[model samples]
Target chain A: MPKLFRKVREIRNFLRSFRCSNDNSNSIGFVPTMGYLHKGHRELIRRSKLQNDLTVVSIYVNPLQFGPGEDYETYPRDLERDLTVCEEEGVDVVFAPTDDEMYPEKPTIKIEIPGLTDVLEGAYRPGHFSGVATVVLKLFNIIQPDRAYFGEKDFQQLKVVQRLVKDLSIPIEIVPVPTVREEDGLAASSRNTYLKEEERQAATVIYRSLLLAQKLFSSGTRNAKDIKEAVLRALLSEKLVSKVDYVEIVDEEFRIRDDQVMEGDRLLVALRVGKVRLIDNWRFGDEAV
Target chain B: MPKLFRKVREIRNFLRSFRCSNDNSNSIGFVPTMGYLHKGHRELIRRSKLQNDLTVVSIYVNPLQFGPGEDYETYPRDLERDLTVCEEEGVDVVFAPTDDEMYPEKPTIKIEIPGLTDVLEGAYRPGHFSGVATVVLKLFNIIQPDRAYFGEKDFQQLKVVQRLVKDLSIPIEIVPVPTVREEDGLAASSRNTYLKEEERQAATVIYRSLLLAQKLFSSGTRNAKDIKEAVLRALLSEKLVSKVDYVEIVDEEFRIRDDQVMEGDRLLVALRVGKVRLIDNWRFGDEAV
Candidate 1:
């Protein structure tokens, strides 16, 4: 690993300097995170290393993307531990910029996806994906990565990023990796650490609901409304799963499907376990019986 | 000009084909425009040719950026004349792609700017800048120009593009060339052709109001409200100027300014000269004065 000690200005300066440098073979892969390193993040970075010549990981908990009363401050962060993980993962550079550094002045401009952001997670978290799109785009530019990796745990987010890249013509490839899960099939997430002992056990309902939908789909249940009801019932039965935000069965492009799920459709589910929201998804035809 | 005849498969295919061609010395400067070519567009291409080793001009009337009942269909187009202009301007490539070629599938994603876009033209034509930002970004990615030229006639749009490049970290340099105007102080625009002979004369008020603000500012008038009122009165007095949309003095960054005028601030004004809407602006302490 090539260690680079940098502040915000230093990172930007380094990027400018590298643009003119004759190191053409140096391919940089980037993984941007909101601090609080988790196993899911590690998998993203690990995959990045295997593909690129150098890897850069950015940890920034962006405030713009957070709506009023959302967890902007108490979102959980540990830079010291995160640095340790990046070092172990063979990360060439670790960018941990301050809020002021990331946003030198008030952001007068923002990027938004219209219809896509109005559904699924977007509906629940209003300007959430817009915030995500803005920060991720900023990181993409600052890091200037050849390839960026995103996990499918945030399926809607992956879709938003895909649209952003396509619409903006951003010159980077977005690689969507499989969602990492815990032993009981609960999707691994940084927020998962927020769950209490009992809440942790209840969090498994998210995956359980997805599994229920998958089983039904395999058993010739093609009606989206019926499958959605079955999944909702499974989540409603869990004691610790306080609220179900949404249970959607949509096509690959995230459009709501009613009757039949074609070959590449996905069944996505999001539920709240003790105030912590967890999301998980699985493709219809790809799951084993 | 090495003209190659092949329809592009996708944005990626176009970029790959351009990159594979072994011509490293030539730097490409791009000027993107709607189909109807005018003297203003020709000027942009001329400047592009002088500044870059190769010039590329793309004629795409992007529909995603136009709102319903906003003259998207009635927008003027003359491909043969546009080609003649390109050939005259020494343009190395002319990317005249069909709508289906550009958007093989419907775009699920869009680009939008918040507070900045919510006011002025954005208020009048909702989702206008979002459409502009989306299409401009796409063009930027497809062309991959070293420098992109935009006229200052669309002052808000120039600001939005600057913000997009800054926020997104796009590598291309955004160069804002001066607005091209006619002999009668009317800013040159393709839409000018839509105006009747009398409406064309009345359109001069758009620039006249901007000039009035400049005169007031230069004659030791420091109050923003007084300057705006003068400009508004000037536009309302014109028989052909149907409606005065807005007349305000803002700081360089498009922020509303109420106090004494700074040296580098701008006075942006817009109005409807008959059925055609026109906008113009002047910067304090600039050579255009």
Candidate 2:
């Protein structure tokens, strides 16, 4: 059974004790999540376990990250099931702090990157990245992991964290794990549970468009605008995708590429399938999206 | 001889090596400054040395903290004299990175407190605290010291750092040393070197006013407005005190107090003596300011 900590202080003390005794290999690997574990989260846990001597998982549905009317209240959380998943995955510790524990006082410090933050997801969901950046930094400080793991599914978020760590000179390596998807290619997300049966099935179109963009890029289609247009067309073609929020081809740094798509570029898409917002992305060289 | 590190990566490696070897006593104390060593900085270093097994001092003239038309270009710096001061204070290591070394790339992530940041010195120097907060966080991440020392002279900055560390759950403790002053009662500062002989003589008014406020507060005068007015009057009485920036009485957290000055309250003042800007503060319970 994995030890469960609901208080920040308790978990910090527990982690410190573990850190002190585990001097032989202090490579602490951390995977921060918002609970409701799925195959995507398991993949991150597995990667952390393999790369580090100790693996710690944090499950907090950060209210700060969700904007007004953005499903914060409806976010899926099953502590029992999440604990079971952690134990099965051989997680060293499971930190599940409440809203109060995470934010004892109203947070005054805001972490943001200007140009990178004010576009794409940030453009649609204002102040969303600031919340993510702030909470991620707090988690990093609390865990003080040797290396932290983040899935590439949230491509912009991953870029934000990478830039934040690099710009701030935080002494931790951020390991990016490829997104895990269903057999039908729908990206694994707790929000997927909110999707009606038909909407869930239709959600595969999000990934399908990404795969199409990747395929086009692989087949000598170099223009970023053309790739984005093709992705937009594919996404809009789906009857269930009610709205195409954005379809962009960006380089590794999340900067929207105006010219040719390189080997390491990213194709990111976000859309609404029956009112459920979904996002997916794929790197150019990754095994088919 | 204290180890000098100009590169972030090299200093990080050297610090890590020292941290690994000196595991028994990991009480690393840090004092971060912008060079031009003074009695105030020396006081912080000495306190760090007295309290911790190892004391590390960083001297980087952070450009981010200075806004347009500020004194960043003219900021005084003397590395040789600073090195001698650190050596004299028994500093274990001195991390002094150049502008290029510290800011290898443009920084994107900024740390700032909302209400606390918009008043006092923050109001006078726009983006100053944000710059201060950002650099302090970066240095804190790099050093990862057990206890970090800050002087009470920059009282608002101390409060901001305290709030940041607490809000972020940064495990390191913040130790505040009292402001060091000259025999004439003027607060010590690097900018003091820029003062003309006459302006230097008149600079003592900044401290005298604080002492006057302290005397009044001790004599059962609690009205914040009254205390502020008296302090302002004392400052304006000095001919060389060209301008009075602000005089405020607030709690330890820097919230402006409308009522009486009680225990743990802070009375802060900032004024200009000719071209030189000076600041000073006194806690209610401190002896004679």
Using DockQ, give the best candidate's number.
2
Off by over 4 Å in 1: A2-28, A223-226, A258-264, A286-289, B1-28, B42-54, B196-202, B222-226, B236-238, B256-265, B272-274, B284-289
By lDDT, who's the top model here? 2
CAPRI rating of model 2: medium
Kindly report which residue pairs in candidate 1 clash with one another. Answer: none
Positional deviation of residue B95's Cα in model 1 after best superposition, in angstroms: 3.1
Model 2 residue-pair collision total = 0
lDDT tens digits, residues A1-289, model 2?
8888888888877666566554524678999999999999999999999998889999999888889989999898899999999999999899888888889887877777887878999998988988898898899999889999999899899889999898888889999998898988988888899999998888878878888887887788999889899989988888988998988878876778999889898887888999899888888877763
Off by over 4 Å in 2: A20-24, A285-289, B20-25, B259-263
In terms of docking quality, model 1 is acceptable
What is residue B224's positional error in candidate 1, in angstroms?
A: 4.1
